[model samples]
Target: MTRPIAKPANVKARTRRRQVSPSLLRAALVLALAASCAFAVPVVLGALRPAQSADGAGLPPVQVALSGLAAGACMSLSPSGSNAGKTVFIDPGHGGMDPGVVGTVGGRQVLEKEVTLGVGTRLAELLRADGYRVVLSRMADSSVTKLSATDSVAGAMTASAVHRDLVTRTLCANSVDASVLVSLHFDAFDDPAVGGTETFYDAARKFAAENKRLAVDLQ
Candidate 1:
């Protein structure tokens, strides 16, 4: 006979965090970046714009001003149209069996996968039109890696399958010798009022400084 493991304390009282999914914040960021690409300019010089909350209310002016200041620091990085010779890798987060955070808009259900794919695809198109070679992790509503029969268990993605899929995205970027890799994701909280742009970078990576600088510019 085996004993059942006890659940963590306060599990019932804690507010559940919805899985991070694409939101208005991400859509704003991606569209802004895409517009920069359309101008054939380095992304740092792009203008920053205010994003709306979940309820379509505008963000505070202070947040927009701060983002502008962060972007200003990128002016020293590159000259105009430097991206023409670069290869960019765009990874649209979550797909296939993973719907990520399911939220509602206009009283209708919206899937994170759909939002991410739309944003990523548009970004790729704009970059390509500006003479940058772009590679996407997945071009459709499917897994980045070839799905194995055992990839899913009990209607959820298996741990190994998740790992394999993520690894494959990195491998795809590496294969193309990508100049910049942009993995897009949106955030969510239990509170429906939350909404804002976010950018993340690995501080421990060798290119940490560069990554951080780019993140700051994007944010």
Candidate 2:
């Protein structure tokens, strides 16, 4: 066979240089990938996380803020002799299965439960703003009583469901040692013509005078 022509000197020199090993190449690629991931992870996580205030504080949920005003926990508006020491219990009448009244306005349903709850919630907010502690009998359209398995069972256990609900509301007010118990309800009359705000208090209550004054103020 004829002898092969001699390769170019530059090509021979390049061929003689040490080639990069496959293992080293793979290790370099892995290191590059790891570095990219290390830089990207915290950025992705921070974007996905809930936003914090500039001071790194997170806000309380609305429900928690509304329901947090228990006895002795109210933030006082004044340094001394504020309404902070007083707790008020608000009862939104007829929740759950007990819709107190039903009316139609402009072809839309007007539920007393919803109305009472709305009023109670607004009143609670107002009172809390005035530095008073507030507790609601039912925070939403739900029963305040921790009842039995069934309505009948609950009724049997506590005489009647209506009575049980009333008792539960009273107990809640007492438990919180509320300065005042405001039971909110919408009135319905047989004669649609008669409509006005009316407030009543138990005549036998020891603080009947104070109750009357409260009723008058409310009216």
Candidate 3:
């Protein structure tokens, strides 16, 4: 204890050794520069863009072409005379891989997609008999997006899939020049005791009043 212990001869040299190698340092710097350029390029290009459309005269908006349907995939009923020319589009929500809400009744399984399709098809048949041109978004248990040929371009992202499916339904309505669109869906809740029917409309849409009236009538 009286004599102090001597330090190692190489202690200073070991402490001075760099933890990071030269190649590693250079790689980190390169990655940083790449990230910076990636972020900056989009902003610079946007700033340089012209104010007007590329074409001298603004071009018409592109419309998605309707795709052919599988055998008995969709139902279209034409009116006889009274309500002729009036078109109604019916959309049954959820299909294909998206089974939608699931429940059990009387020891049997029930899927929202199946129920919606059944009800929607029956409603379409009734509407047709009442003299209205009716179009079913999907007569079979498949997604509207999958029925469309353009769905291949829709990315694999979940949000993209949802958007494409919804857009496909709207395009179908537009193609038929539908006077009204009836979208059928079944709601689910955490509480098993709760059950009801509800209708909703987008207040910001141009047809807000008409949509509201339709909701009230359904209610």
RMSD values, in order shown = 15.8, 35.1, 25.4
lDDT values, one for every candidate:
0.51, 0.48, 0.50
TM-score of each: 0.63, 0.60, 0.61
Task: Please give, for residues 171-216, the per-residue lDDT of candidate 2 as tens digits.
Answer: 5565544567777876444333334454545445556566656655
Question: After superposing candidate 3, which stretches have Cα over 4 Å from the reference?
Answer: 1-65, 68-75, 80-82, 147-157
lDDT (10s digit) by residue, model 1, range 93-169: 77788776666666577776788889887776666556565557766777776666788988778988888777766
Better of 1 and 2 by lDDT: 1
In model 2, which regions exceed 4 Å deviation?
Answer: 1-83, 152-159
The TM-score between candidate 1 and the true structure equals 0.63
Q: Number of the top candidate by TM-score?
A: 1
Off by over 4 Å in 1: 1-83
Q: In model 3, what are the clashing residue pairs, if there are any?
A: none
lDDT of 1 at 189: 52
Local distance difference test, candidate 2: 0.48
